[model samples]
Target: MTEIYQKLENIVKKEFISNSLIVRHAYSRVVDPVLQGIPDIVIRPKDAKEISEILKVANEENIPVIPRGGGDDEFGGSKPIGDGGIVLDMKRMDNVLKLDEDNLIVTVEAGISWGKLDEYLCHYGLYTGCMGPGSGMTASVGGGISHQSVGGGGCAKYGACTNQLVSLEVVLPNGDIIETGSQANKFSKIPFNRFGNGPDLAGLFCGDNGIMGVKTKVSLQVFPRPPFAAYKTFLLPRKDRQVSSQIMLDVRRKGIDVYDLMYIMDLIMRVGCDQGMFPMWEQLKKKRGIIFYTVEANSEAELQEKVKQLDTIILDNKCEALGPEISDGNIAKWHYVEQGHWQFYHNLWGMVPALEPLSCECFVPANMYPTILDDIDQWDMEHAKDMEIFTKVTGMRPITGSGPIFLIDGNNVELTCGFTSFPSYYNGENHEGWDELNLKLWKSLMGMLTTKWGVQWYMMGEMASRIMAQLDAYLPDYYKTLKAIKKVLDPKNILSRGKFEFWGDGNK
Candidate 1:
């Protein structure tokens, strides 16, 4: 153990206590950066060789390891559970390898932040061209690929990070390095699209939340900057949310162009934004209990055309326009979100409770969206309490590229609702009245989604394991085969453990 620590210290080059502190803290606790659970040791490798040497030792010792990057992942991606294992901090490996402008692709070390890549590409007038969280800030290329982080900016153009991936250099459990695709090539590259051939490995790491192996280097496709952007707002008159939601669906069903960034702000979000703290929500409440929209177009002419159709749909649905629209306001409200005002989007709720689970998220078709979410909400109201939802990606694939639109993506639009269930005792109603009862009701309602409506939960978390059992009866042989491949790639079970477990131990 002394020898291991010495070697780790050498790799990280810490000659004193202060130097050791650099290796101790993870960015997850940045606000409380000096709090509990400091890492046993931090190994910062400048290259993959140094990583292999450290990993070999850790493996031989049977010590657990945590891979880290930008120190984000709201789901707690970078947190370590090691009894006394080391953190293989990847940030030191940061390097931009190649930028193929002609191919619209860029390659970089796993530690390179999204913002760094964006700045590098922008010099040449290009980008990874995906809807992602905070391209101007720090987020490793590998971490982005791992979480499949999708945000507002690129939803209309690039989709998720997986869609932009052209190739990767992955180091498997045995420390064997293998390339997945060409420098800028994929298995499914047609005249216009790139597809993963022979079992798309990108999907394996994309959103795996780093349970398999540490990502070393990645190659991704970029895009040219678009010209002309606009935001439009509307007020659905129907105090009945169902009526308004159905109307929104109707507009999409007719194949009319709509907002790239779209959603229905609930009363909680309505109330929170109304406090004048969140500018977006404040502007949004103008259309109380109504639909608000922001549209992006190629030019002014196309913009006017889409708006004309939107106006027609609004009038037909008995919804009316609100005063002081987004076009007039420059739609600066979205920045509140990009700048980390998520609570604004949460309706009236504050920080989302850790243990809160609503009913199953069912991605019913757009036609069924209003009715489905509304019915679910009513069930929770009468049967339990309040709700929250994210509805989109029915037939209207506003996200133009490939990958998951709805974890609820088959026959439905994906929506989620939760009743507040705070972990600790707070001053007043941390979880009083409806909040307390809803926790119990949320459980029963979820069961109903599975047995009754066949509603699904996005398989991005611990719940995925439960779904896998139910799916085995319905899954094809290929899925079993994929599980086998997962076992081989991650023999030690060192990857996104339990979160998105792709392996079945009994199978082996």
Candidate 2:
């Protein structure tokens, strides 16, 4: 390991590489309470060429190489699945390479955060559609593309961040650097399209979860920010879950061009208000579920028409409108004008101190979520006995529910459903058996959500990806084809090894 560390140091100067225990320990964990893996070395490469050299060395040594961007991923996608390997930190490569305003395209180093990129684009009155992810303040563009991420503003209009992709520069597991999209043509001077040269190979790297290759550079289409905009929030009647789901379906069915539409469940409203997480809704007499909409347009007429259509759908469903001001429970105004999207998308995770989330993010049809949400309630009841173990120790039962249901592209919605509980090391004490119980409950919930609900998981990281593979959740031919592709692109399985049971020979 020391010799390998020295070899990596030679690739990315000694100052940028570390084998210290403290540094490796820091790279081992992510937002999850689980400690996924420990790294033998952590190296930050400044460019694709340096990453190419590092990958070559790792391939020769048959060592695992995990590419990490920003380390803001909650799914453990950037960490290794084993005890020791090299964690390639990509933050050093953060830079905007180009901005072709004429063509409405912006090229950037993959490690650049969405917030930084947005700030840069805002200077020119442009923005990246889908604005990366809910954690876009620090989540890297590479990580967002790797997961087809959503939940940020404009997801209703732009879908995933990958939807606007024009090109990508990826370093394969075997150290070969290749450009996808129009750049695949050797003589092409600029990347303007994603589908021309041969296949849409850029897609192979998108949402690959760090298994196919390391993303180094990316080019995405930028949209001009509209001048006309309007937002509204509505309080729902009883049976809010079913009612909220219907509102989302109607918004899609009526062809409403909304920028953002979200369903905040009653649990979040009540708990968030009680915990003071939602100051805007403090005065609401009924803390039931609420739905909000944000719309933007090139003209005031278009914006008004969209708002009028949306208001009719929301009001006809027996919902009461909050005041136009954000202070009067109008969260949509704050979400758009004040940049509250990043802060509130995952607020439920911090509803209680020291309670961490074991969550699953997935896409499901708008109509199916009400049933899924109800099933989650039933799931909570079924797990009451197991939850009591935590309640006995901490006097607080684990809280299980779905966070805000975000209306994403098409007729789908993004569901961030999970339970939060005290970590095994709560209050700085290691409680035996707590870790095992947490894993057991997490796996069980994941199994139920996947098998019974048939939801499509977009960000299956170390734990969820492995559990899905182990549970035989995927069809036989689909699994076989994925393995074949992995074998072809990553023969040694050195990149993101052990994911989907693709551990390299003798490594398992």
Candidate 3:
């Protein structure tokens, strides 16, 4: 056994530290099929103390330690980048520490799945406000918070995972255990507050993507479940993207208690049609946009009033109601495929045959949606013709794009827009060749979006380091401060090396 393995074994039990080839291989694999790096060892720590000890040893030896929770991120965040090191799997630490119903707060170990937590909270008629990712069934609480995922039930109302986060118990790279937010207070029994009479230290780790530290536990604010829910669907003219975007803005501006508002673009409709997923695709073939919205209220009267308000806004935007047939069917299918027992693995593993999907989640200005969609369409057309990939003979098409924008804050429409791209590749027989082309296309598209629209990548993983580096150049002082923090917190840079690459050395 290697010296590092010997040291890790001392920190955890021998059963917890495995250097076996099979185990290491399994640990190396992630949701992204294109990116995989086998770690030297896979270590499962049962608690933060064990993680702290492991970090200390890793720091001393200058070995990279990548903390992984669920390994379900579509972006290559959890996968090792530099020379392989240790994969610190936190699944063994799964626990629901406390449920402070009085303050409407829940404290859970980072490794607990969001689905599990939501299930447990349902018994109490309470739920987290944050919109979990489609993979919430297996996606851990720490994973969602670290990545800042935005989608599920709370998209229109409470925003992303970061919004629901109240506090965090993190293990810094130097192996120091620190609690951020109100949890740091001596007399605090519940971490219901976020600011904590300080400069929002908890916010620092919210979207840091595990680059800052390993989140061992998290405290999130919860809300009582709404008693009533309703859904609606609107069909917008194919040529007018602004109408749908405006309608979404109006919903937030009017302070509608919207649970989820999803805008499905034409390209997505076509893809769904191609996959035979949407039977109503024929009717929407000429339509440019379809919107599905879910509103919630404490009473049926309130729900009806909200729906009436939504209808007025829809008609004002020159959108036609597609009736409940489309909306209810889509919502039912969404719940069945996502929240139900169907095991929604299609997000990571491409469901459509011979096609590999890659999504670039971003937060852009609300007003830029139309222009961005236009640009993407133009790019798709040009690239499709040039690459000879979009042909009837090949049964392959251009990179079809769709975005569902969510409001981060109802008060400020400018700050509300969260847009994400769903792009795919038709691999056919040559998987390797197509995968290479897909990666190249994906990077090019990302570069265009970042350069032209100033879109911020939602999942700041290794793939996003270059973009972060460029963004850092625009704010050298801020990045310098971050680098300094990294130096102090992780002197040896053992935790998530090559992530948020602003340090002088690539690994550091």
Candidate 4:
């Protein structure tokens, strides 16, 4: 065996990676699967110590390393970004370090799936305040933190996933297992006002996308899972941007937590995930539509009240209906049976580029989701005629973006959107002009959004400038300090190789 192979075997199980193409496909990314030469071996580390050893070996041999959890970022984050490297699958490292139900906080390994976390916690009548749709399968706590994921829920009530992070247990490339915040007791007593003592160490790696170092364990804030549940899914018909905005605004006016969400159907995708559809990409090439709806409430009573209000709004506002699907009324229960929300999204679309920009989420203050859509709708109408731009507006009531506890009362009001734009972009049927069209549309919309809209979409994906653009607004000096820390911490750039650069190029 090669020196690299020998080193990998010394640390973790070797069967983590197999030579078969089938294995490669399972481990690969949605966009560029065959990265760097498909890592010679995959390793599974059980704890921070083992992770440290794996990183040390990779650094010594100068091999690439990709630390993956939940296996969700099929585009690039999880798949091999380099060759002959080791893919650290932390899926087996799932151990809930601490579940302080009283304080509403839980510490978990990066490998724990979001759904699993939600399900386990739900049993105790408590749920993660940072629950996303994927909180139900493949979404990992670490991965969500990396992307700063703002799933359909909690986003309106608990802040983004990163906001729930109270502490972190990270492993740097040099084999140092450092604990950033107080394990449990210590962190709880900290000013709670200053985030953490001194420099706020936990903030550095929260959304670094696994570039700075490997996130082995995470500490997150939890919430009452709510004994009663409701999962009402509404279907908006056609492209009535004005009415959609009005409905969302109305919900907030009446005090409802909308947990924002959005979806647009440009023919190909809807057929796949829609109830009775098979997603035969070849036949369903003519279905251009939109689904503007909301999940309603976090409780059964709240859900029913919201349903009545929604009926009034739809009727009064004059919007068409796709259909009124019954609210499951048991969201936490459904979350478990469904595996996870990544399973939710994955089940919806069948045949598209695995890397198809799943969804781009960001916040421009509260009550802005609708306003942003209003702006985009106006722009689309004026600029393009050959194209038909549809709109689906979903809002989170009792918006989580609020202060103190992202909770909703009569006075507080805010809204956010899941904002999706997968218009006319598919792999097989319209592979000709669809690529250019999709690229043009995505770029145009995003470019306008960042510049004209004047607000940042934090989880839109990793664009050096766009991601960096968030530096000053929400977190000042965060990037500069993070880069400097990466230099001092790793200096070898062998940890999460593609996440952030440390020291110099080719350091390891």
Candidate 5:
């Protein structure tokens, strides 16, 4: 290991390589409470060339190379799960390489934060079409692309990270550089298109979670920043989950250009009310769900016209408007805190008051939302009884949480619905046992989601890998093909070794 570390230092300079216990420990910890893997060494390469050299060395020596960006992976995708290996930290490569306003695209280094890219583009009256996750402030563009993250702005209109991507420059496992998308053309000057002459190679790497290769540069589609934006909120009556789901489906089917739509359940609202985080809590305490919409347009007139149309849909669906004051205030607060190197969602941690928060997210079809929610509610009721009693007796908060599902796309018959659970504690005396139980329950729930609910999408990390493996029996060829592709691209299994391994190579 010492000899390998010395060789790595020579590849990217001694200052860029670290084998210190503290550094390795920091690299090991992920957002999950219990999932952790310590790497033997960490390397911060300056560019794709440096990364290529590092990969070459690792591949030749048959050492695992885990490519990481931001290191904010909640699913343990960037962690070193195999025997201790090298963590290729990509943060040092942060830079916006180009902003082609004429072509309506921006080329950026893989390590650049989504927040930084948005801030830089705002000055030029442009923004990326697909916004990032809650951790956008710290999450890198490559990391989001690798994970295919959802949420943020424009998701309702533009879909997820892969939808915004136009091209990518990646370093393969054997130290070979390749450009995908329109950029692959020898005469291409800009990455304005996604599909080129042949196969869409860029699409292959989008959500693979770093198992395929190391992305060094990314080109994404950007849109003109809307000058006028409108916000509205509606309260769905309790006992009308079907009606609530139907209303959203109608709004989506109507082709309303909703920039952002968030469905906050009653449980989340109650928690926010107790934490004093939401000012409209008093007015909406009894509501079954709160639906928030942010619509943007080129002019105030256009924005008002869209809002008027949305109003009719809300009224026709028997939903009550929460008024502009409450709705706009909440939207403004989120924007203010999330813009410019901000971490708005961090405040939610205070409510859970946990050292580390554990969450499980899944993407189910839009039509399945109500049924899935009902199933989860039943599961929570049955499983949370013991934790509730334990917390009550110990003077600690119970392990309770909520799942917020948002519709990403509406044009397709099978719309994408992103469901995320609120954070829960997994620490403290006596709580450790509950934590283990909760983890097991969460994993089982994930399995059920993919199997019973027909969920077809997942976020990056080890959980996704496990879910894929769990569902492999239903799609043997799909898993086999993925493994075959992995073998071809990374023959030595050096890059992100044991990650997304569905071939039964002892990774599971």
Candidate 6:
């Protein structure tokens, strides 16, 4: 074994550290349809101190380190940008530390999956307000926080998962351990609030995409499950995008506290139904776009009032209501009552055999999404030639459009926008130049989305993060300030090196 491997093995058990090719290959990519990096070693540290020790070795050796959670991100966030780095697999640290019912905060090992955490919380009649990304079934809490994730459920009321953060135990790139929020006061007994104690240092790690630090522990506010709830689904009239946007605007203007509000475009409905993916909507006559809402209240009377107001807004927008049963297309009910949040978000992915998604999930203003969707249709047409490459191999071109548009805080909505295409290696044949074409066309789409629509992306993994920098999206002063902070925190740029071009610039 090499000297660096020996040092890491000293920090963690031998079984948890592996430099084997099989193990390194497994940690190389996430959910995306690309191989991001083959790490030199993959190590699972059980706590902040172990992570600190492992990072210390990496800093001393000037080796890159990437912290990986559940590896569910569609972007290549968890994987290194290139070969030869340490993949800090945090999965072994999964554990619930505390549940302070009085403070309504739950502290957990950052590597714990949202599914596991929610299952634990459910036993106590509480849940993380934003159930986390749609992949919450396996997506880690740390990954959600790192991406400012949303779309699992309750985002309309709770916003992104990061909004519920109370504190964090993060290991800086240089192997220094620190606590944020109230815990920053060493005398504090338990984690309480996220603001105040300093300038919300916890915010730096949240959505940092593992670039700022490795989140070892997380404290998030939990909520009691509201007693009274109502859910409904509606099929929109013509001009679905505009109508859906209007419905959300009216819902916000009316000040209705909806647990979830979502718009599924016509393309997804038509395609999904054809593929037998959305059985709930298979009975619809028009196969048009659909909008749904779920509301929660402490009292039956209040619940009825919110439902009535929301129903009026939906009907006034010329939407036809589906029956009240799940079999009758009430996806809203399944999504809210049956915990379908984990299963329902990725309706477009793998809709066809061998198809995978190359998408961007981000936030856009409610009013601006309709125009952006229109532009996406235009974008698809513009790239017809490039798409022909896929058509030639698979007998059909890629499907490009937004998947689900969800209403979050304010007038903003979360949009999973992009296309699904077959990877180059399909059915054991390596289609030459397929990967290059995929990157070219994908980057072009990213450029259009960033420059034209100005959408704020949350999943800034290897692809989107580098594209943002390559596109010169950040203002000079803004980029400079970020670099300065990074330099001070990580002088050697040891953690998540090459992200946003934040290589070893400290020495410069």
What lDDT does each candidate get? 0.51, 0.88, 0.71, 0.53, 0.72, 0.89
lDDT of 6 by residue, 274-325 (tens): 8999898876788999999999999999999998999999999889999999
Tens-digit lDDT track for model 5 on 1-508? 7777777788889899898999999999677655668888889999999999899888878888888998777767788874488899998888999999888889999999888998899899888877676678888999988878776556777778788888999999999999987888878877878896799998889888899999999999899977888777777776455665676687787888877666666776676667676665565546367766778889888998898988788778777776556443354335423451134455544455552455566565566677777776666676666545445645564444444556676632122222232223433344346555556666766666677776655565876576667666347787778888888998888888776664453332
Q: Give the C-alpha lDDT of model 3.
A: 0.71
Query: Per-residue lDDT of 1-508 in model 3, one digit per residue for the tens?
Result: 4877898898898999898889988887676556667788899999999999998888788888888887877667786875478998988878889999898989999999888898899899988876476577778889888888766556667778788888999999888999988778878776878885688998878878888899999999899988887776666765556887787778877878777666766665666656666665565536356766777888999999998998899888877666455433353235422452124334324546545455566776566777787887777766765356424435554455654444554522211121122223333333336456556776777777777777767777676665557544337787778888878877777888877775543543
Which has the higher lDDT value, candidate number 1 or candidate number 2?
Answer: 2
**How well does model 1 score by local distance difference test?**
0.51
Q: What TM-score would every model get versus the actual structure?
A: 0.71, 0.98, 0.89, 0.69, 0.91, 0.98
Cα deviation of 10, candidate 3, in Å: 2.9
TM-score of candidate 6 on Cα atoms, chains taken together: 0.98
Decoy 2 TM-score against native: 0.98
Q: What is candidate 2's lDDT per residue for 384-453, written digit by digit as tens?
A: 9999999998888889998889889899999999898778888778888887888888888889989998
Which residues of candidate 5, in runs, are more than 4 Å off?
Answer: 280-288, 326-329, 332-344, 385-394, 397-401, 411-435, 471-474, 503-508
- Per-residue error (Å), model 2, residue 92: 1.2
Order of candidates by lDDT, top first? 6, 2, 5, 3, 4, 1
Model 4, residue 222: C-alpha shift (Å): 2.5
Q: In candidate 6, which residue pairs clash?
A: none
Ten contiguous residues minimizing lDDT sum, candidate 1: 395-404
Q: After aligning candidate 4 to the native by TM-score, how far in Å is the CA of 297 from where it should be?
A: 7.8
